[model samples]
Target: MLPQRVRLQYEASVLHPDSLIGCGVRRIPEGSTERYTRWINTITQDQLTTQVYTSHGPTVVMPTWFCSRNWFQRVGPFDEGGKGVPEDLLFFYQSLRRGGGVARVDHCLLVYRYHEKAATHSVLEETIWNLRVDFLQERVLSQWESFTIWNAGKQGRKLYRCLSPANQRKVKAFCDVDENKIQKGFYTYEESKERPKPKIPVLHYKEASSPFIICVKLDMTGGVLEENLNSLQLREGADYFHFN
Candidate 1:
């Protein structure tokens, strides 16, 4: 699935032919008799592809990884944090950063077993959040001059409050389809140390600007949000990005 000039690993267990599927590892428990984990579900190419950027995890388990020796050397070593660290994830991000490619084979090639003593459990949720945010800043926000946040709800506000000061200033406004949020007019940052704080304006989605940093999760709404987004005719990853 790799391009002629691009170095990539092809996975068949979960990818289309001639296309890279960042494969997902099937999670299992040690000494368990179940054929599949409770979470076992069909994974498609679209989900596998987006997981790298959106979820910031190894789309494929490390064991299924296959690449040329030279490419492996270029990608370099995994984090030696030993435990409580997502070394595979770290390496995958690095590979993407280095222009490495990823694809998945549409066949189950590995069984990833988990146990109470497994190191994966040691990684905290907050740690992953911080990493995802950092990666977002590095990969997307840095390239844009400014952007709007697509939601005026708690999640959008939280993202605004958590961003680095420099990135925080880049937020033009928050947009929403919710009438209540739009009627409120503004969001005041009570947590800011500035004497007057910051009161960010909230506007209807139609009036908002793009490129947008969408804080709204996909597939949760009953097509309303998607319809609104589609109406704008903006391109994803260029005119807008998703942080949800």
Candidate 2:
């Protein structure tokens, strides 16, 4: 971060809890002497339009977060949690803590270079799963007294397995279109801590009740799931929400 070589730099752009980064870049042409001058020229005319998600966090040009040095002196720096830890999420969390708004610029202001070996690829699918499960429970499941699971298939069962025990008890029933699962009458949770394994009833979508946490993915259903929801005359966000 040499001052002369740098284009725009911030100290700690994180808003204490909100890590909003002010972005700019030095378009140095293959290590040319005029690099800083070129960066200055590039900086003069380009103010990228950014949108913020207040509930979420700020997103600038993928690579160019532009906050001033003095401003960063107050806001702070990014958390560099290496390896599998999600650094972007960590920053977003900190940003929200600092009361910085989440936003993004619609226009492509910076060049995002792609390569075969990016650090982001180090994260596994299961890590994302655990995070999503935790978030869903916090933001949604905690609000409900009870709810129905939309499918009785493998995916639905997988979601059931991932739920917290207290949340698991709140599952009223499993709703499905498959005749075999419905005819099975109930699903046995063989892995439960209770003395007797929990046997959850299976019901037809119309016969079962809401509010449903639909585990079915939209496009994969080939419109069948959509049709079924529509047939029941249920509303989204209120009656049910898509978890998949």
Candidate 3:
């Protein structure tokens, strides 16, 4: 359990009753889930919403969450489905849909333990991927007429295949730094029943247009990917949203 002062700090930091308040966390055994831990502790305040579509599950780790009872009742009773259900993520998404906000206390208030037997491991990656795609389509993709995907690699192609037929039609290109993928020119949707397979152009990142659904994972590229993106000078939530 957190010390009294930490609890007080969290309570004091609440911006409003409607906010899903979380705090930074330190993982047990030091390096477990290193990238995920860094993401939870370091994302900017605005990224609490903007980065919601990423594979990280939730921008704020669920164990650190606190909220008013009134707000909780409004946004959730949580999914009662047993073991495999991602109740926290489901609740988080519902809260966002109901005009709730997210805020972090910016202090390490929890020691998040990682174990192979944890209930979280019961939840399948594909389950979360499908949920994320649905929410992204509902909240962000519906607003764009066309967009570029920031990777021409596995993750990017998976996102394209996962999108609904209507949203898939909105994909103008897949942009990448890989010369081979760029030289290949286009990605064909071989799964589609349409007589002419849908082909999406694969361009160098500099040649692609925004708004973009970036499928590239941040921090993993040793800043090369970030450098490429920053060069574009595009607004994050508006010009792009990270879906990795």
Query: What lDDT does each candidate get?
Result: 0.68, 0.61, 0.90
RMSD vs true structure, all candidates: 6.1, 10.5, 1.3
* Pick by TM-score: 2 or 3, better one: 3
Quote each prediction's TM-score. Answer: 0.74, 0.61, 0.96
Mind giving the per-residue lDDT tens digits that candidate 1 earns over 82-185?
Answer: 77788877887787787766665544445666667767778986777688788878888888888888899988997888788888879889999899999999
| The 10-residue segment with the lowest total lDDT in model 1 | 33-42
Clashing pairs in 3: none
Query: Count of backbone clashes for each model?
Result: 17, 29, 0
Q: Report RMSD for candidate 2.
A: 10.5
Candidate number that wins on TM-score, 1 or 3: 3
Better of 1 and 2 by TM-score: 1
Flag regions of model 1 displaced more than 4 Å.
1-21, 24-51, 59-64, 106-118
Instruction: Summarize candidate 2's per-residue lDDT along 11-55 as a digit string, tens digits.
Output: 333332233443433333444324232322232212111212111
